[model samples]
Target: MGLSSRSVFGLVVSVGLAGAVGAQVTLPPPAPRPEMPEYVPPSQRVDEEEPAFDPSSVEFDPIWTLDEDGKVVGPDGLAEIAALRHNPLITEDLFPIIETILEDRAKEMDTKVFVYPRKAIDALTGAIDNFDVRKEDTRNVMGEIANSLNVSEGLVSWLRDQGLITEEMSMVSFNIMQDYTKRTMDQIAASMPDADQLDLISHQSRFLVRLGLQEPLSAFGRLSRKVLELHPDVVENAAELLELKGRDFLDEVAKALKPLDDDQLKALFKEAYESLHGPVVNSADTDEKIEGKPVGDR
Candidate 1:
């Protein structure tokens, strides 16, 4: 007697319901959590034994060997002998042994100055031997010269580009730039109200040198005269400005002149004059008033 399909299905559903009801039933409380172990910090731990400082010893070959004449013959020995002969401190041998030690000590302390290493000398000689007057090489030489003279390489390059200088004329270009800078500085010093103010003149010269101004100093001299004509008190004004602004005023002036074309530069000079003099009432106005008064009609 096999069970029917419907009876089997009913038996499975009843089993599933029993399992669900069992799962819904409340369980007893969980057991208390186990206690955690205390922490042991690394600093509190015991240290391991340290190893001893013994290093493997090595034997070196002797630098000098005795000759039949009982003379030290190696390179180092020969060098030491040469040093002994040259040393002025070993004048008269007081005690032979002490003199030897003193000579060795002096040789050890005698630092060689102004000496180029053999490899360095060789390299420099090689470079000189291989030197060529190519465009790039010429530019490099010009740049170095310009740097030494405290002028700008760009100025030199510009001069070359303008055909004022050629590759063969690099040194000539440098001399010209140097002369220009000196002449410009001298002109500026002369144009100053107090040419004897060396410190002030030096400051101005350094400023110009840093700017590497390409224009002739006569242009600047003319500009200075124009400034004075517009405002006779410009020197006093400059002193006040310097006191208030320190180097900033000079820096700003340099910046303004840096990119100016010739026309723009001339306009700038005129504008500076007009700006200073524009606000002042004419002396003719006061004169006119006095003249109209009819010589103090009493």
Candidate 2:
């Protein structure tokens, strides 16, 4: 063993060559460490069998629903639909009231009753019955005004610009105005003698003509004119009274008329009627003129 130096040197060289060969061999990166799943408590774990999102499974609320018009299906919309469905203008039997009012008028007028065409009664009756419809329309308009940022906000802005209305009082005024209008409508509908009022309107030839011509809104406007002509003092102070105390104004108006007998009422109606239509032109007046003419002129 001591004499084998050449053999020992060859063995060392073989060991060095094996180490170099192992270093030269490239190994793939140790397979990336497998990631651990995040720990979840038993109570917090989502079940694997749970269903995915489904819209139908959710509860429906009409308030949140968008209608065909892109507006919310709110309580107001529902009420309007119901109101239109049950409106007396469309649904109620108005013919009975019309016949009754006509019969009463005929008894009073005798031969003169024939002068009023059936169309006049139809117009007046329709207007009276449609009062509820008009009220509903007014409520909708007011609701729209209140809901619209542009209109309501514009009112506030305009009031501020005027320097007459304080910001706090502007909204108060708006609310009060709405309340006054609603109360005024209620008083007029409840206290004004419906039958007598109908009769009063029946005598106004111009009012009937206007209503028959499909100018109901204009006919209503002229009603205010007639009221002014009849009671100028009452109307002059109406705005102030309405703002301060709206409920009693129309009641007082109704009470004032209670003292008049039939003859007195007819006289008032005649004045109003004549003022509205002028003197009734007739063939008799024309005949008088024609007969008075000179023969040669004729």
Candidate 3:
């Protein structure tokens, strides 16, 4: 079977069968790959007429394979990756380069910072399943998160049915939901016939933006009050908001997530993965089941 967050772990022995008992699996040895040259040119090669035979050789990594009947034939690529987590063979000398080529992918992904409503983000966090490349379920699952944040409610029932969002995570994501709702309310209030209130509300959004540059907590409340004055309606239900206990929550979250930028997270993710799992094989051939056809793409 292919890999996934659910079936990704397995490192134990039995007792009476007495070791670990969990959902897990494995596969065969890999093929050796051809050594890549340091450099070459079209013109230089043609002139020599010499069959540019190579003398140097290096140990190659085996390629994982599968069969027509869908049987995993070779050592699982994912399993190899998993084992590398604790292996010593992967080293700086052997492997080095690793990072996502597309930086903008972060905005495209359905991660929490980008997702709205927050429930969709919760869903992905809760999922633990075997993956099928033919189904391309990971993208679909993530898209659900994006849609929810975007206010596209069509997938709501599917989300619930799929158990994408667990009860615990859903409640956590509700913080995000409430935050968006509050932002929406602010927008609506800003759109009212009252010009002064609209400007005031807009002011809050600006202050929130500028909050990143400001030293934490130094003048936060003052700016917040100014924003409130510009859009006083936010405080119109001060008693209810206070009862709801959402104000401090919002402030706390803003502070916590504010400094975290995409580049930093991307680098960190790659760094951590490399630290645990040998090195990430970026630019390698990734298998994609496109329209039921298995194809390799970089």
Q: Pick the candidate with the highest lDDT.
A: 1
Q: For residues 1-298, write the lDDT of model 3, one tens digit per residue.
A: 7766544443222331332234332335687888988676776655657654221222233233336854333232122222222222234342222112111121222221221213321332231122222344743654453333322121212223345433333333333333333544455454565657535554443333222212112122222233333333533443332232223433542333334465543343334333433454431321121112211111
Cα lDDT tens digits, model 1, 1-298, are 9989999999999998899898997668999999996787989976778854321121223333457855433322222232233323333442364344444222211110001111112222232223333435633543342232221224335334545334433333344334434545555565676645655455454434333421212123224344344554534444333342323443333333344355544344544434533432342353233232221120
Q: Tell me which of candidates 1 and 3 scores higher on TM-score.
A: 1
In the range 1-298, model 2's lDDT, one tens digit per residue, is: 3748898898889998899787897657888888999999999998999675442333222222346854333222122222222222322354354344434322222112112222223333443333332255633532332221111123223424545334444444334333333433444445446546543333342222322232212222232234446755643454443333222332333334334454544344444444565554552343343232322232
Q: Per lDDT, what order, best first?
A: 1, 2, 3
- The clash count for each model shown is 0, 0, 13
Give TM per candidate. Answer: 0.19, 0.19, 0.18
State in Å the error of residue 248, model 3. 3.4
RMSD of 1: 33.0
Candidate 1 lDDT score relative to the true structure: 0.37
lDDT of 1 at 91: 36
